[model samples]
Target: MTKFADIKGFVFDLDGVITDTSVLHGTAWHQLADYLGVAWSKELADGLKGISRMDSLEMILKAGGKENDYTPEQKVELAAKKNTNYVAEVDKMTPANILPGMKAFLDDIRDKGYLLSLASASKNAPRVLAKLELTDYFPEIVDPASLKHGKPDPEIYTKGAQLLNLDPAQCVGLEDAAAGVQAINAAGETSLGIGDATELGAADMVFADTSLVTLANIEKHMA
Candidate 1:
């Protein structure tokens, strides 16, 4: 097995990697769609996976054929409403909501002395981390609000590497979305994607799910 000798840090995306808050986000969006008389579908929910909040809202609005119906202020208000719903559900999340094998993986990463930080597009990332009781492992979370660009842009991953005081090349980024894998690659970091291998082809390595994300497994499989 090839060891990841040069890797010093791991930058993680929150929603799908740490927990499944995307369901809450989709539910919130669905509620907003209901308010706008728009039909919700799985494809629309899937499309929102790794993008910024405003971008997700824009996609939903366009899908509803109501993109032009609201002023900028009204759109912001609508997004806030959706956030309210998402927050209500996320606040209910406990460590039990952490994905399978993820807690052990986190403990292993921590014990092994790798630097850790977060690069999630979600503004609620801090809250979710706190809810999961995993904040001690990640003190630096790249602020989504401060970023000028979102996933597929590399800015968030680049900033996350900066937070760890490490070069992007010395870090490995973990994500569950195609856009996120692209961002990590563009940032010059090795991407470890957790999800469908075909969909996350940009990743340097792909695991079927969080349960398979062990470090030993990664070194065994990653090139």
Candidate 2:
């Protein structure tokens, strides 16, 4: 039997995994931080990865010692502003923006008969996939609006497995952030992190980048 014999589905995180829209997200957040008179840093931007819009906003506010400055209503407006900026950038993406080897990896997984689903914190996931013309590859995308918790909570990853009609243990969750990897592991899925190994040490496996995320590589590591 293959090393992934029991795995029936693959759950993917958007942003850094399927495409390079992370910079777009960062730009949007930076714009919002500027509007709020908050100083932004690369470290703060890094912490926002794999987290929800509200969560990211909250973190940014706290980093600037302005967490209590905005009322709940103002926070909502700020988040909407950020999303508006993000969607504007996302609108410019094309299929060519799909990460190296990611398109081929999706094709290969589908050809091999494994189900595919997405578990993204971004509300613009559908738009992003559509922009990249990769919607058909993922039959299910767990709705971020339906979840009560975000990454590092396991709610999203667990919902992803349910959407694929599989148990968490029977699925492989791919992510490029520490929070996402932690969420996948908490959900009982085999976690594959697609970035720095040390940063995503919670994952069951780690690939340097999407270009290295081939069936052969996955199986070789699992074996």
Candidate 3:
């Protein structure tokens, strides 16, 4: 059990950790792939986790052998289209889309006086936060637009901790992607891995889903 006594705050990855937006992202990618006549699979989409939207577009285009002809402007346009689709889908998300026990955990943490922040590679993070009505929960949002590098580099997480006025060791990072877990670990913070355990082998702790990540569970680890 990892102790949370030293932790002063919590930082979360929006897409998979807070909401079921991973499926929406994958769906949007597949839609774009079909429009571009590219082969897009869940495996490829999964591999693109924690990367920026532009980078993801480039990867998918290169994989489809269509990277050479597409202009930068075209790539931007396509990415915007994907966002449009994603936004429409996100608007339809009800409370049901929020992972189980996440609300309870978030309430507990906030009530306990832990500062909360959001660190995500998504450029549309602000929009997503607004749409989900989760804007009030996070005081600081360090996103792709705020950093030169994305996950696997630890810059985002490091900056997040800096913005929150908390030490890396005093923050708990929650993520569902392996890259995110790596980023948290590299930042010297405790990472609670959510979702599929096989992919997040590097996480300090693993839970099957948000439902397993209760305040009691966190306290137990901290103890």
Candidate 4:
């Protein structure tokens, strides 16, 4: 086992990592597609994971053979509608909705004084954290709206490390999507991939279940 004792900070991707909001996001996207009379499937929504909402919208448009049909403003409006749908479920979130092991893992890291940053592709990250009462663990959170690109691009992870005053090499990134794993690696950090190992090839380690994400386990696997 590798000793990850040298790691000083942790960068976490939202959605699938801290909470199960991916289903809500996928539902919202599907609703928008139906409302717009466009075709969308769960498989297509799967591609939107770890990606920005507008970028997801563009993909949807292209899937519908209408990518160039809508002007930028129109696409923005549609994306806003999708966001509205997403927010309706925000109020439903409570601490209980946080993954089984996330709260404990976060508490452990916080107690250890590990600098933590939440890098989410969702602009709703702030609200989600507030609703889940997990905002205190994250002093720095990347606003996807501010970024011109989304995951698979290393900007978010790099900025996360920068905000923590740590070198990317001194941080480990946790994500549940392949693009996010790539982002972490691209930023020169070790990547912890949650969920499917087959889908997270870019990660340094993959855990199918969250229950095993303890500090000891992380150190062992991420070392």
Candidate 5:
């Protein structure tokens, strides 16, 4: 078993883990789909989780049989348009938007001297953190804009570990998306899932949501 004293840090995925921005993202995608005259629903929203902006657009396009109709440049523009809508929604956000059990949990982690970082694929991570009054909790926020690849690629998680000066195996990653969990595990850390059990099947240990990923359970993964 991995012991508590052996772990060096904890890295968390943003969006669903830190706050419920999934709905905002899904709304943006739905708006894009509406503009494309494509029917959008939660099922389509499910495919957007943990994916890049353009990738989500492509998925929606493919569902509408228009994936190949647009050039890469056009796709980028469309994705940017959708992001504008999401940003407007995010601007309305406040600190209460922080997810349940997160503030106290993060405080406890810091109190225990465990290095904490945020490894989000969102280019607006810093903005969101500031809006939620969470900027002080993480000194190292991996630059999502610098990533050529997103979750499930392990690049973000690896960068977080590097920024913290910790080995991947000596860290733990918390996520609410299957792709994020996969990225965490691929980076050699314990992947703690924070969502539906069936959806996060790849995680080392799955919790229903942020509230359930208790410190006791977290320490159990240390080695």
Candidate 6:
């Protein structure tokens, strides 16, 4: 087992990593599509993962053949409406939706004195964290609002590592999106891709979901 002896921090993507808000986001997208008279498919929504809501809305509208009809202002209005619906939907999130093993894994890392932070593309990240009551676990959070570029750009992940006072190679990034895996890889950090493995080829390691993420597994890489 390889040990990352120099590693001092862990950076996680908020949506699919710490919370199950991906489902809510997908539902919102579907609702938005239906409202626009388009058939919503998981295949369509999946392509927008790890992007900002604005970008996702643009992609969705384009796919639905409404790009030209929807002005930027209108897009913002629809996106805001979707966000409003999403927030209401996810208000049901509890400690149970924190994934099967995330809390324990987070606790283990904190207990071991690792600096923890979040790098997420979601604008609703802070709200979701607060809703899940996981805000205390992370001292720093970088969202799309904090950067000019989103995932696959490496900016957010790099910024997150910098905020933790750690080099990119001295941190581990956890994400569930292909773009996020690519971003972490481009940032020159070890990345553990979670959720669907097929979309995570750029990751150094892959786990099916948060259930598979454990301190032991991380320690193995650190060894």
Q: Pick the candidate with the highest lDDT.
A: 2
Kindly list the per-residue Cα lDDT of model 1 for residues 174-205, writing each as its tens digit. Answer: 99989889999999998999999999997889
Q: Model 2: runs farther than 4 Å from truth?
A: 33-75
| Stronger candidate by lDDT (1 vs 4) | 1
Best prediction by TM-score: 1
Off by over 4 Å in 6: 34-72, 196-198
Please give the lDDT score at residue 191 for candidate 2.
Answer: 94
lDDT for each of the candidates? 0.89, 0.91, 0.84, 0.87, 0.86, 0.84
Error of 2 at 177 (Å): 1.4
Tens digits of lDDT, candidate 3, 107-135 = 88999898999998776777777776778
> Which structure is stronger by TM-score: 1 or 4?
1
Native-vs-model 6 lDDT?
A: 0.84
Weakest ten-residue segment in model 1 by summed lDDT: 1-10
TM-score of 2: 0.84
Q: Is candidate 1 or candidate 2 better by lDDT?
A: 2
Model 5: lDDT equals 0.86
Candidate with more favorable, higher lDDT: 5 or 6? 5
Please write out the lDDT profile of model 6 over residues 1-223, one tens digit for every residue. 2257778899998777887787888888888888988778767988876666888888888888888997778888998998888988778677777888889899989999999989987666777887778889887988566798777899999998988999898899999888889999889888999977677877888888788898778767556
Q: Which stretches of candidate 3 lie over 4 Å from their true place?
A: 34-72
Winner of 2 and 5 under lDDT: 2
Residue 60, model 2, lDDT: 96
The TM-score obtained by model 6 is 0.84
Displacement of the residue 121 alpha carbon in candidate 2, Å: 1.4
For candidate 4, write residues 16-80 as lDDT tens digits.
88998988888889889888778877678778876667899988888888888889899889999
Put down candidate 5 lDDT per residue, 114-160, tens digits, no spaces: 99889987788888898898999999999877898877899999988
